[model samples]
Target: MIEQFLTSYFVKNGEHLEVPPKYISDTIKQYTVAKQTARTYRNVSFLKVGQLTKTKPSQELINYKFTKNAKRKLTEDFSTIQSWIKEGWIIEEIVFAQDGRTAKAIHYRIGPSLKYYFDAQNEQQTQRLENYVLQLQKSADIQPIKELLQAVQQLNEFVAMPIEKLAHTTKLTPHWSIEKRLRFLHFSIGFFQLANEGVLFDFKEIGATLFDKIGGSKAFDRDQKEFIEELERVFSVQTIDCGLISLGKITPVFFTGELMGHLAIIDKVLFMH
Candidate 1:
């Protein structure tokens, strides 16, 4: 039945059937026989007649020998093989080849049949399966941009405060010594220098024109202390010098605080170090 089905379905078309090319060659050898006989010529010259005959094998003739052999080697192997073939777990195709001395031979293309089974399956089903797998892979890949975006939004809101009111509300505390103030100012300047370009600073030269407006380090320290105190009072935030000032949270209005001015803290010394 299988051979008949293959013959009818694959052989009718001029195009070779989808069988293994080797199978086609083997089939041609198995089913074709050549007979040679002496023939008499009219001129009394001897001639040899070579006749090639083609025959179709019966279902029993084409029965799979491996099935029986496999069953003998391992019990139930034949049944398993039959089941796989019937369920489209194996597939076969017809192929053709030309010979220099004789007519072309027919071969079969054979392989595991799952591909043929799916050949008849719905395209949309296949696409859905592929898309599902892709989605699974995409989900497995992680991203960190969301948290960064949220942080940026929060920071933007904090830097939107009005400057004048912020400065007025801030006041220096006794705990904030001049030395601490000077250090904070120095650190702030450094942070700004790293964050931006075109900034002028002269930390080594005391008499440099850079500090002329602020009257050098002493005046700069005093101003910074007052400014920070006023900034804290107006923004309702505490300033800690853990290398970088950490104002836990601030409203957008606090950005415009009088002493702090409009500033966005990007990469701080704390994070960089």
Candidate 2:
């Protein structure tokens, strides 16, 4: 329950707040009471931030004893919660009374360092990318891609093709079938993965290359625009002008996950072959 409270607090605020020790206990009590009163009352807000004071806490809170085990659990839960924050994850500052004999309140805020938190996020993002690839494979038409990869591997005459020529030569019909579109996306994914690895220059280059793949400037304007739009939406892709006198230059803003090493699984045509 304490962990949930802390997690939600971080998610909602994405900042630090000074919380009273008694307030935490009270909040937990409210949560327990809410659960008991109504099963539907599952989520309770814990956004309250208390001001620190040099004076002693009120008698009611002082009389309210927080268990030693509970404190330990809260500490452990906070350590776990800190793993989720990317920025100043959490800073705990103890405010002591003027007498210097007793602690007053603990100040919580975004801190400066949390290396392990980002490491955890990277692992999760990588896993998400892997899962996305696996899911994409289930629906994407990839048999032709596999065969094309094999053929390319066996051929020595075929050097890597230039982006402009490929776009100029290949022409998309007025309409694209769903199967054909998915097949095209399969290749786009390969290009994106390659770009992620720094093998390709960037998203703009990938865009221009892909723009040509879909039939270049000669293709119908509506179809080309729609295809490019979908690519941008799915992969955080963007297009740029390389002064090629056309939409031959492109760039990508971001790729979701790291799948460069696992090319065979993500996109076999470019990486596997």
Candidate maximizing lDDT: 2
Model 2 clashing residue pairs (backbone): 88-111, 203-250, 203-251, 203-252, 204-250, 204-251, 204-252, 205-250
Judged by lDDT against the true structure, how good is candidate 2?
0.36
| Per-residue lDDT over 228-259 for candidate 1, one digit per residue giving the tens place of the 0 to 100 score | 56444533434342122322233243334346
Error of 2 at 247 (Å): 5.0
lDDT of 2 by residue, 1-273 (tens): 333434443333323222333334321211111111332322222222222222333333223232221221123455343331212233333444544335565444422222223345557865754554454454333233332443223221111223223223223322554334444454454444333333424334444443456544333333455655654544344533211123433434555764445445444333432
Candidate 1 — which residues are off by over 4 angstroms? 1-83, 99-113, 116-147, 150-273
The lowest-lDDT stretch of 10 consecutive residues in candidate 1 is 41-50
User: In terms of TM-score, which candidate is strongest?
Assistant: 2
Tell how far residue 37 is off in model 2, in angstroms. 50
Error of 2 at 80 (Å): 22
**In model 1, what is the error at residue 238, expressed in angstroms?**
28
- Candidate 2 lDDT at 248 equals 38
